[model samples]
Target: MIKGMGLSLIDSLDTMLIMNLTNYYKHARDYLAETLSWDRDIIVSVFETNIRCVGGLLAAYDMTQDEFFLKSAVDLGDRLLNAFQTPTGLPRTTVNLKTGAATNPSWTQQSSLLAEIGTLQIEFSYLSYASKQPRFAQKAMAVYDHLLTLMPEDKLLPIFINPDDGKPKGTDLVSVGALGDSYFEYLFKYWLITKKASRWGKEYFETVESILNTLAFKIVDQDEEMWYIAERQNKNINHKFDHLACFFGGLLALDAQHAPTEQMRERHMEIGKGIGAFCRKMYTMNPTRLPCDFVNIVGNTISNPIAAGKGWLMRPEAVETWFILYRLTNDTKYQEWGWDYFEAIEKYTKKEYGYTGLRDVTDSQKLEPDDVQQSYFLAETLKYLFLLFSPKDTIPLDKFVFNTEAHPLSFFEAQ
Candidate 1:
């Protein structure tokens, strides 16, 4: 359960600052200063630690210029660095905070998820800059550099990779969901965070072109066309879709503004709208007005919920995309869609103490709460919702880049 990691508290630090909750922010800061400790021997997820804890600390430090935040972030970043001690310098899934030992989770079979390793670039790069430690940047870049060597001309990255030899593992499967979303996410964001001075933009665009050409497709449903990104296993395409991928809509919209050409910009924005609409439709299609975690698209309908697909974990991806699309296009429809989704969650999932996830989004009458409130519900979902209705200038896209956890780390102009 990642005990003592301060998941929700640390993850929501930037949101408190952005929302102008001064007392809450001060209390959180004091908690981090007075209570947070990394000396425990607990095993923590490297990806989650970086995106939530380190990213949140860095975002707070950047906004407030407070040494305590930076000190906490650097301390956490140093411990996380041990996860990259693999032969390929790709961070494993979990690390021991006390002993500096790292290992892949048993289920991963000594291989790391592509997103887990690839998502570290932004957090560590900023940490390096903030702490004046080049090793942090170099260690994170090593993973990206090694990945560049692995990419074929097609640029569709495998979801699983063995850290021992830095080779693609398992079937040649590629997805922009669970195992691979933030890898591509960080590629584009690192370029923005660095003020476009790095090779990240070129790499990001190349990979995105491959994603559009190979993975993205339109599924027809009852005479309606919806755009969704599919997964590829070798030569075969799988019609499985994840709500986690709903983030792509916002990401595409964000990328469109910075595209190198007008055509690219228009193309990305058009597709972004399609994907955003597709995600919004899921809420209406379900009886409870909430979408499932994942579903299989069978021609004209979504059927066969797999694993935990029927559950709604209060995910933020769809709303995050809605917020970005609304901001970028000034479209009131996006805001309308987001409001509807928020209202549904409030009606069904809200409890006396705190909100929880739904056990089954498809059943209107039996909307049982899972009793677990995810940290992202605060770090990303609610934060995105708060920013959605706020003035666009509150956290301008030009000045700040968000980590996957929704921490707004500001842009640093090139020297």
Candidate 2:
């Protein structure tokens, strides 16, 4: 057919990047070895690699007629599915790239109480879509089941949950407030993908609806900003919510899709806008030209009196506004803002040890890398920036890659 033409020279080059990027599979097994010292590299390879695989495989499947690329993506999907298995049903945050064993543990791994929970959904969904396998969906469903039972007493998800024991770990309602939307995003997304209309999804939707309704009316200050009320026991933390609270934009978009009222999506867009506006105000009000992490402090207020302010580099989520603005407007301003934010970070923060020195003002210009450089930062940061800066006509990332697990999940789609 004349409709299909020969590939351009650029296609070949892009293919090479995909191929070479993926060629590290053999080394993935030894990810924990000292040789691959950059935690980001190992995390990117074993865990975060899913984003690229999904991107490459999905892109190749849709645009190119390359069977090898598609099959390779499918094979990677299968390997990831197998790697994610755990007796407790909760997957580890970090795993030994080579040995297929659990390595480091972040509380976020279990409770995810946020979008981090969607890791399996993305992997399996891509596998299912790319390879047409039902097994991937089935594997992902198991994770949903496991995560559901781990919810805290108030129905509010915690910042962290213990992976091994299936219990709460640290910082009850602190880090990932997006855990709320994250759970709903995958639940509803799975429903859409499989057309199964899961009852679990129905229940989750109902609960999330109630929470959103409550958050809509509740205000911490006159600023008219709504935050997920952090619960210590029976009381509210009343701290100002950070936009990067967890999967805020993407999950909100997913929820907006299923909202019974059109106002829901509009409200979400408004929230996204508000975050940017607030950032602008903060820059002006502080007179420091530095972005504020969050408003209000609660609980014990550890190293920093500001509950959310670990520092400029510590806030992986400050970019939430940037991501949301771009998502809402599809304009370069947001992307430019994102780039500006990164530049400020690069200017004020230095990469040390492995982290971007969570505390910029406190580092005394000395480097004390992050205890955990956090794959989440790169996974979210690069994907958002890439989509923002990249050509919108050819590729617009409504969903970005988060992580890659080692297992053969192509079977999920096939089934």
Candidate 3:
């Protein structure tokens, strides 16, 4: 957990940078430099380290113009490269810090999650660009090339892929949720960071259109139209949505403003608003103004059909979407909704140690706390909420693009 706090500190610094809190900036920078120096041999999970450590270092360097941060990022990037030593170039999930040994966990069945492999490109590519080490980006982009070769008939990728051979696992499952979320996210983000001239931009555009045509569906018989993207396995559609998947609405909204054609732009805007409304229901339908980890859409309404996993984990996707929609439309309704959501979290989840996950959001009387706060609660959830209420000039949407983890990266102009 201490290792993960590097991301939180960097995110706090980002907020400070935007607010021009120079005093706080110096404190943060000092603390970050100190933190980066501690425990050089602490083994780290690739995904966690990449998103937080590598991503944080890059963002910090960008904000501070500090060579120390960039040097640390390059060092971390070199250590992380050991995970990519597999035959097919899809990295293992974890790596040792000192020994540089890497391996997938025994339970993973020779396959890695799509999000794990696909999400590395943005940070790794940026590291390559900044550090002038082409190998980092080359290793990362190899995973993308391998995934393209294994694209399904529908062109949307499954959640798991064999790292050894770069093929989709036996399961036909496809989702924009947990195991799949950041794959699509980095696609668009990589395009933006690379200035839209790279293949990533074209892939992002194509994938969004494919998802709209294939994976996205509408809940039937609802008074107001609610569009929900679902997972498919072996021709069976699981009419469920995850809070994490809610990020798509905001992504769609952001992309809509940049769509090439007026028709395409309007279509994206419509989908974004529809998805945003559906996600809002995930909160308004609950007494606690918080959603379970996942919810089912059946016939006419969204339902918590699965009782076992009904919990809220301080996730930011829904609120993140609200922030983007609010930014795009300047609609006070999004702000109102966000404020209400924040109030509920403050009322229920706040604790002496830190905010925690809720075991059940529906039972307002006995909101059992899960007793752990994830780093993303700071890096993403609160950050998005803070940005939502801050002045528009702070991290102007036109000037920067955010990673899946909410770390902002400036657009790269090709030389």
Best by TM-score: 1
The reply for model 2, stretches above 4 Å from the true place, is: 1-88, 92-118, 146-175, 178-185, 188-204, 213-235, 238-243, 246-250, 276-309, 314-321, 327-336, 342-358, 361-379, 389-394, 397-415
- Listed per candidate, the RMSD to the true structure in angstroms reads 1.6, 9.3, 2.1
Q: List the residue pairs that clash in candidate 1.
A: none
Q: Would you give me the overall lDDT of model 2?
A: 0.45
lDDT tens digits, residue span 279-388, model 2:
44343333224444544434322122343463544343445545545655776666766676556556654455433544434333553344444333444444444445
Score every model by TM-score: 0.97, 0.60, 0.93
**Residue 202, candidate 2: how far off, in angstroms?**
4.1
Candidate 3, 1-415: lDDT as tens digits: 3643465675555656665679988887887677655335666789878887788778767777789889988888888898998888899888887788887776667678888998898888888888887898999988889888987666788876778877777687788987888898888878777778777777777888888887788763357776778888887888888888999999888888877789878988888878888888888888898888888877667887467768998899988898999989999899998998899999999999879998999889988998988777877888888889988877788878887777787877432
Which residue segments of model 3 deviate by more than 4 Å? 1-7, 19-25, 38-41, 220-222
Candidate 2, residue 139: the lDDT equals: 71
Best by lDDT: 1
| C-alpha lDDT values of all predictions | 0.87, 0.45, 0.82
lDDT of 1 at 80: 91
Q: Which candidate model has the greater TM-score, 1 or 3?
A: 1
